[model samples]
Target: MTLNSGCRAEGKTILVTGASAGIGYFVAEQLAAEGADVALGCRDAAKADLAIQAIRVRVPAARLRSVRLDLADLSSLPATVDALDVERLDAVVLNAGILLSGPERRVNAQGHELMFATNHLGHFALVAHLAPMLAAAAHSRVITVGSFAARSELLDLDDLQSARDYRPKRTYGRSKLAQMLFGFELDRRLRARGADTASIIAHPGGALDSLTPSRPPLFVRTTAQRLRGLPAGVVLHGKHAGAQSIVRAILDTESTGGQLWGPRVFGLRGRPRRETPHAHMTDLEAADRLWAASVALTGVDPLVRPATPLRK
Candidate 1:
């Protein structure tokens, strides 16, 4: 279902990362169509232009701009924030991510494991840099896109950088789990600072169909799709149904500060609905550890006070 133009984001300014394609692209497009000024954050300037051009073609009046953002590079984050001229942001969507199968562990220039660096750490830095703008907005929201895979993983603070061992899929799951933990921790921290910003999490539930050669093997990815559904595609079990969940989370007033919204059907394919928090994700101690490591790794602290203490 398409989001109504009269929704909460109307007249607000939002920045969507990894908007060159997939759910990020759709989220930006939907937000723009609803009368929001959107900043499309992408790694490639040319691709970002193309994506913005596509959006303009469909919505000629769309108030959209493009910025270069590479989630793998922690240093590039501050520049991205500076490029956004607006003093405050109504919402920031940390949507850019990577899913790869590596035969051996790989590290980025920052000396971080490729999967964790790109998926979790990058976003961690971006949010910290944008924290001031978020706080300035006061009551603004931060919607992070996460996955169901986080349920199977636990945060290993001792090896957050993946120095000891690494399995591509498992590493990816760990990063996602970290993402959710950070989101929840952000909400708790905001409360401690008496800031009104809300941190919410949403998952697309695997309906994405677009592919690149570097992605997972055809049979494995395709099997996941078939098991999910046809019209929804393999990535999404139901056709664009995952989009509704995101839209609802972004606009739903009833949603609390740290809620997880998933699709309604099996594999989270249908309409949007509130889901129970993953058992592993409820560990506040892990969340606090992940937050501390994220701050040290990114060196961007937008919080006014120290992070909230985790429960035992």
Candidate 2:
């Protein structure tokens, strides 16, 4: 199918995290197919190579490469951010995340909650480090993948790190809220500085693996999932459908920063459309607080110049 005008990504250089599979993979593939130079971010080089190879088969002329990125580890971030060869970044899709089904609280290498670290803090660091490069490009955008969980519960500012009260579902919900908070606040800051970059949050509702495209062998669903059916949202949709909202956030020139895009019908399944976020998603006060905390934790200021030189 042909991409709509607002969804076209030709002549752009884009980076998609968690692109080894799932929503991220589809987003990267679609961007490449539309003539964007796509960079796939994966923790493992081999897996990245394979994903890019697969994309090339679908679009032989695709400009695709792999960039090593470990969201759960901060030490690896500096090198990864400095190593990106692209002088301009038209868009950055922060789509990598994890949902822990086990009833246990896990921490990352930094001793922070794993889901929160991977889903929010990791993207925060990446955006901070890449801000300079992004600002260099006209009308660049950072598309952060949020989730339905954000609207379900409010994050505890007193315990943003989940130190005392840590529950898997609550942590996941908080992570998504953090993403929205960061994205919104980043937009406000960029606007204040008159930077052309835009920060947009996109949520994909109920895109289950059963309805999604075929996965890499290792990520395929279990027998139970196939037999009982994948858990869906208010409506069941495929990964490709979910990716439309993300693509729109990146490509829609008319969409201003700080807007949340998601499924139109009950946020379950439908074409992407602008939707009012939970009251807290646009709370600038909370955003400021989150920004301060993120800066302290990540040690990378969004407006500061990169510590290292950019090399291609």
Candidate 3:
């Protein structure tokens, strides 16, 4: 599929969460190269600075800044976004996420599951707080970064927190699935109201840190690491390649809302292309349930309109 780049991001200000490392870092780097003002949304100021420095090294005049954002804490979102101090945002890449390693289920300060909190709820609230800034732009986009792992999982609305059953991979997949659902649902809501913003979902397919190129202090792939990952190159790609889906979602003017974009090869490792979301990911009823649950958990409704009451 030939991707269109008609919507150049030059002169636009974009906010990218989790921009401190991995795929997020590369997304910020690529956007900077395109002449867009890239704001690195990170929980750690120091790390964001390193990412900015790294990008500047590559793109000498890279326009970048750090915005304090911690997706783990719901209460911090409003203040975090307010700190941006920008009247308009051309796009927002909700790419920050955490994958728990141990078998135990982790929870954030607010007691919600850690992965679910950061991966889904945090982004949900962040979008709510930034709705006005997004609407302020003549045309804006909210690109939610999901995972290919979501294809195998289903959200248990009752067990969203994984309180009932918690296996590391399952929980992580469900969290990502919830995020994708919100992305699709947000698109529906935006279109239903004829809003200026568009919501799109993009997944990094199968990105391996070892396969990724070095970005210095933020990411360093030793020669050994690169060699170790060479074999997996047949089906996996580096974070830089993984970031293409996000870049396309943000800049492809022809790409409409609710479309899923990922790698072209078996949705794993290749150039970015439009892909079909799993059946469960497109269930409207489940999407609505997840939406209500998110609002109840975060107390922030996205795209609030007086005429249309919040969905229950």
TM-scores, all candidates, are 0.87, 0.91, 0.95
- Give lDDT: candidate 2, residue 147: 87
lDDT of candidate 1 over 1-312, digit per residue (tens): 554344646678899888877778777777777778999999998878877877776678999999889888776666777788778898888888887786688888788898899888888877777777887785688988888788888878999967887888888899888888888888888878778899898888866553211121111236554544455443345324555677677776776688988887654677788888876776788887788777777665547322432111
lDDT of 3 by residue, 5-111 (tens): 55557889999999999989999998888789999999999999999889988999888999999999887777787789999999999999999899888888788
TM-score-better candidate, 1 vs 2: 2
Q: How far is candidate 2 from the true structure (C-alpha RMSD, Å)?
A: 3.3
In model 2, residue pairs whose N, Cα or C atoms come closer than 3 Å (at least 3 residues apart or on different chains), thus clashing, are: none
The better-scoring model by lDDT among 2 and 3 is 3
Scored by lDDT, the top model is 3
- Deviation in Å, model 2, residue 278 alpha carbon: 1.3
TM-score ranking of the models: 3, 2, 1
Task: Give me the runs in candidate 2 sitting further than 4 Å from their true place.
Answer: 215-234, 306-312
Provide the clash count, candidate 1: 9
Q: Model 3: residues >4 Å from true position, as ranges? A: 1-5, 305-312
* lDDT tens per residue, model 2, 266-305: 8868888898888888887888888888877777777786
Go through the candidates in order and give each one's C-alpha lDDT: 0.76, 0.82, 0.89
